[model samples]
Target chain A: MSQQKILSRPSVGAFMSKYGIVVIFVGLCIILSIMSPVFLSMRNITNVIRQVSIIGIVSMGVTFAIITTGIDLSSGSMIALISVVVATLSQNAMNPDQPVSIVMPIAIAVAISLLLGIILGAVNGTLTAFGKIPPFIATLGMMTVARGAAALYTRGRPVGDLKETFTFIGTGSIFGIPLPIWIYLAMGILAHILLSKTKFGRHVFAIGGNEQAARICGINVEKTLVKVYAFAGFLTAVSAILLTARTSAGNPTYGLSYELDAIASTVIGGTSLSGGVGSIPFCVIGALIIGVLNNGMDLMGVNAYWQQIAKGVIIVAAVLIDARKQKRG
Target chain B: MKKTVLVLVAMCMLILPTAIFANGQQEDGKILIGAAMSSFSDKGQTYLQDGVREFDAENDDVEVLMTDAKDDAAVQLNQIETLLVKGVDAIFIVPVDISALKPVFKKCKEDGVKVVIGNRMPAEELWGEFDVYTGSESIQAGILQAEWVAEAMQPEGGKVGIIMGPLGHEAARMRTEGNKQIFAKYDNIEIVMDAEGKWDRAKGMQIAENWIQSGANLDAVLCNNDEMAIGALLAAEGANLADDAIIIAGVDATPDALEYLGAGLDVTVFQNMNAQGYNGAIAAYKLAKGESVEKWDWIPFETVTPENMSEYK
Candidate 1:
């Protein structure tokens, strides 16, 4: 009997800890649907998914970074910078009608975004690891610098004239699933595999749990942290490209406030703000919760100002619940 | 240190005469027209500079002294005080904040310096206090766009959405209110969503795409300005909804908006921005010359569509 009880205790604890976010998400969904009939419609659900995809994609990368007890406040601004470059390049390509096809533009955008991500990540990682600067300060500086650079690039105007094919990633669908949503899912799957199956993932968790101990165990702490930020940058670039495609224009102001949403979603999904714990699926759920709340508020005719206030309240409530869980532990 | 001091002394020598001459020339023989500009970037600067230049070009009798407050109400007030101290005949102000500029207007009235406000309208008491108020009616711009949409959609009375600028901004609020007035007249028309794009293109695109993906069955979109309207067009094109020819309309006859209209992509209400600059100068010049002027002056706007876009082109 004691053996059975002991076995059940682990299962119960696991259930309580892991499934709690999912339960709350479900509960919120039900309540919102009851409050507004439009919330339950398939169309609205699809809309919510589409709206969440960009933030969800970025948060997946953030989940990996946060698992290592690091933060990236620059992701939002980085997305803006990379997006303008991508859009400007694509616009030029469309106008000249060069021998190179649409695929060439996409390939070029991807390469440029990857490079930008690595460079930005390297800057942040170097400051935090070598210069002994705090992660918050380093990333915060990067955020302002990147946003300023984006504004300078466009000179406070929107870049336009992108080819139709380039916009497909944001608007196109396969099997009735929007392309951004699919891209987000694909990235999420890859992230899940990397975190759950790889030695790198284990190292990340170890470092996040206790950096000093992880270093003693031969974890090459600095390199791992750099790689995590680089990955975050990569994800931010992808979100930027999708945003550009969706807008069919490159704008310096794109993705404003995205970092906050990403961080909020990560924390809401049981990824402790202090770090050492996170799951891809849970973070995705957190993003969806935000998406649903925005969509429901719109459908219910809530004023724009009030919607912002509601979002703040919901975020606070979710964090409070998480805080309670941590206290109990 | 010696070189720095020498350079500082040289700069002071160059500036002292200009300052002294300005103060000396401020008497009745020279009409001192003080201009308080909001900022030196984008539309505000463009208008203020053009106004001052035009005023100087047309009238040799009036000498315009200008100060840029960089969009700070406090700096603008200080600039007014400095201009007042110099004993200017009149002051032209493009205020940063309409409400906060009242005391400056009141001070101008007490000093008997005619105050001509450009672009922004102050509260009723301040308006009554000022010599002349000139600006485009932003609400009329919105109503004009809505009326065009209503005509295009005709009997079906299409479902519409709006991508608006920031709330509480005069232009945004007035445009929205004007659109609502037109919307109230249409029995079949329904507004699905009105999202704040914050006068940003990407934000407009995001909101537009979301509205489309939500299956809102939207037939048209009206933006408070051309920037957001272009954004909506891009989003609709990205979503392949452009084939439906969802009507898109905006205010502000910017070059890009005109280009889009020429391409048969969107409609716009063309306000005479250049005229706003020119007429503002004329008003300021008249006030400085001690000529009587009306308290309020209205600038007209024309609706531009694919059919008449060639004329603008």
Candidate 2:
């Protein structure tokens, strides 16, 4: 197949396979703009990006997990847990007569959340890689545990009255751009480089593609799997911090079933769930498509039920198109 | 295979009754009432449980056997059936979905067990099927929310946005309807956007942020519940909107909402959950004892504004 491709110009099918998803995303934007004038405005465009930023960050992590032939159902629950912890810490610092600098509490909150995310991710990784449990089951168990911990921590009450400095992390802008968008872009770039340029990245793809062959080739498959999941956990902590910031509070019920949205974003971005075939850029676009569909429908005043139906249809269509491309390839 | 079957049957014999009998402690002289909760995760459900516990503490002749349905209609139906098997004198249910529980309610009725529907009312067709329906009038909360919005917008009514909870939900529907009725009275107030927030704070914030960015020229946001109102507040504060730049009103008056109000949220409506639950349980007990009780009991909603914030706190 490679010899034939080197000898001839790329076929129409191949070209479409490479660029079809991008075309669909652009086409959706154009169509939405035509249907609703507000859709194309710069302000609205930024809003859409801002809206997609949370899911986009989390999806980048899930993208890694998908490429490694693993799933992380615990991201949503991890976010819930981390948000509660951070909210509690930040709220405590904001109390009157505290002598410490505001930075102390915020830093401590972020550090604790990151550490907890890593530990949780490591637990999933250990179960899946060493315990020989299926990725789905391992993460599903963690999902429940993490959620319970969050609810138990606050007893179902939402934490509020956060410090101004803590809220600023979510609401503050960097050079007229929202902080979340910058964080998402930075994360996306980092993930792209790690997946495409690093040896550990190649190890992940190899392990996902054929674990037996990867082990035979002297790759530390278990270690790579654990590291991949750890990366996903770290990303989820980042997302939780941003989300908690945006809402200006943390509630146990926050981020319910959000892992499903992240998975959907990854799948819709043309990531093959079977493994070893997805990109961060495409995942961002996929997240954007979802964000656009939601924002556009709201602007057009479509019924929420119809909006859900449309979202489901588009997700299926995206997968169907990807399957068609696979057949051609 | 015969030995395995014998062992399995023995295990079931030992396990089945113990599980069912956990809450089935019925005394000869006491009336046993079964309570099925739709969920215990949210504040409202917890508040309901607190009221029930309060009732149990005060009552001597009545025992309440409660079960959590975990927000699943099927689980709720199963719990009701379990309660029925235990042969409770009466059953009270806060259904996950009013429509989904009709058959179960019918089954209870056929068994001659009195049913009290709490929190949410079933459709009008099933109104006659249940002994009583008790809770706050959901529409009243909406009316209070919209009235506050109207008052805040004043004579120079401005464009408003409505952040609805899950569409088609009875509470959400009634609340939106109430808002519509009030807005209709004032020609000056225009609803520019009415988007579903899916009863989520993040979703509510996302919609509000988008509306703000779209330059929708919105002056107020009416949320069906406290969660969404808090979301809108975050969005407005993020956009650097002045404290009084926009009027925001929400229902439920949750603890978080009250905190938001204390921190400068415009308005909230208190639905009096304690009264609803305590009163509902007492009425159920009265009916169970063959005493006269109101068939349809309504708990009023109180408006909480910044001016009267001290009273609520």
Candidate 3:
């Protein structure tokens, strides 16, 4: 038995580290299915995916940030800021004869949304990389500033009466799939490619793995960090636009506490908060885990108070698993 | 690091100026009224503030200085102190939570600042502290919404689900209690499950979707606010539930939810927020004038349905 334990440790550790989170995800699904038969139904599955998509997309960017040993606290506030701003741009007149307020073409608004994301993200990145400020402090500051800006921009009122086509990005479905789900899948693939197939992705890993060694090996740490944060910010903008479209309004209070969810998804997906080692697929799985938990608990008639407790426990457990794995390695 | 710090400060400069509502100066011969708002970021609150601003814009003798707490209870406390220091004769307050009452009321009383509550209500016991309370009853909102939804279900009372705002929130708790009081009267209408939606649309949408997928012959979806009701409507549509199969009701006749009234949403309660704000300011003005003010300025919560939605719109 002792000899077998000795022989099996290396392979098992490597295998578990690679696929442990996926296993947890599947285990959770099976458990939820047992608790409620509808948990695995086609409709329920679709619902869960749709629900997780926003945070899932945000988590992809967060995964990149985490892999570079950084964080993004500004995602939530950025969502509110972007949504309210973009909603104004894509606004439809209450009636055709009435004067609309600064309505732009929907396409231009979307483009501006993406540009806004890149700029805000670049700010977070720049602060961390060149400003030498910790990502947490930098993004935290941005979070406050962005939320305040959203409120100031609209004076605390929601920007609604959106163009129908703009709302379709959130509400419309194509070929039996919701638009948000399609966006999630598309963003996931794009992020995976950017992280795994490019030199930029490697530099990110190197920075997170050992900044001193990465610098010695001639990786442009500052520039890469900036790009990484910009990517995260850009993704936040996409989410912001989608959410505004879905709800048919852009309230300044939107996306409150969502940063914690995105960060939790990244962490639970096996990304180390200490920085380094994360995956996009794992991030998606992590968000799904949360979605299922919410769906399942609500279905079972669990108290809302208990739902919060269970979520907290699960988040802690995921971090514990990651910590334990790192210790053994 | 210094450059980034400078940049961050520069970014803050853009927003920080909005927070400084008063320069602690009283204009010559003008009555200064400080309005401590719970949030300038909420539509309802904005409407409330607009009512006061309109009052401000019209009168040259009274200048209204407004501060946004951004929905922070602690910030609201500090804002009240700032208002007092600015030597405002009276303050219009929208408390973020009940946290402001005891301390803010005590401080205002000590400094002889007249306090008038508007929009949302504070805790029951603390109600005595404020000079006047002018707002619609949240309980009535729930009762009106619940009564309408219950009546809609008719002879065949059906299973229902409730989506609430943040737990322990005064509005969420009282509104829900109001709903329960009415729901108890119906024999056929049964509440299957209820969960907090955190006053969020996405959370509301997901909760509705999960209830639908659970295959509970859900007859109604009741929400604490219009955002959740609208979300539930979208979820119900997403699930292909027949339009007439479910009764969805929400409080607060917000525009987005009003748009869905006939199509998906069944009923919503209009709290007449602008009137509440305008009246609250008037009450404060009366106190400033040393005139006797009524303790309660109760505004009626009107129920808005498809038939009456046009009026609200």
Q: Which one is best on DockQ?
A: 3
The docking quality of candidate 3, as DockQ, is 0.62
In order, candidate lDDTs are 0.76, 0.83, 0.86
- lDDT per residue (tens digit) for residues B1-313 in model 2: 9999999999999868645553434535577788887776666677777787788779988888898887788889889988887767677788898677777777777766778888886788878888888887788888988987898789799998888888878899999989999999999998878888877789999888877766677889999988998898888877788878888888887877887894647889987777766776787677767777778888788999777877776
List the lowest-lDDT window of 10 residues for candidate 3 chain B.
B18-27
Model 2, A29-118: lDDT tens per residue?
898889888888876777788888888889998999999889999999999888887888887445432222133567877888888888
Best by lDDT: 3
Candidate 3 regions exceeding 4 Å error are A1-14, A94-104, A325-329, B1-27
In candidate 2, chain A reaches a TM of: 0.94
lDDT of 1 at B203: 63
Can you give the lDDT of residue B150 in candidate 3? 90
Off by over 4 Å in 1: A1-14, A32-46, A64-70, A92-105, A193-222, A325-329, B1-120, B125-134, B156-159, B187-193, B201-219, B230-246, B253-266, B274-297
| Candidates ranked by TM-score | 3, 2, 1
Clash counts per candidate, in order, are: 0, 0, 1
Instruction: Tell me how far the alpha carbon of residue A128 in candidate 2 is from the true structure, in angstroms, after superposition.
Output: 2.1
DockQ per candidate, 2 decimals: 0.26, 0.48, 0.62
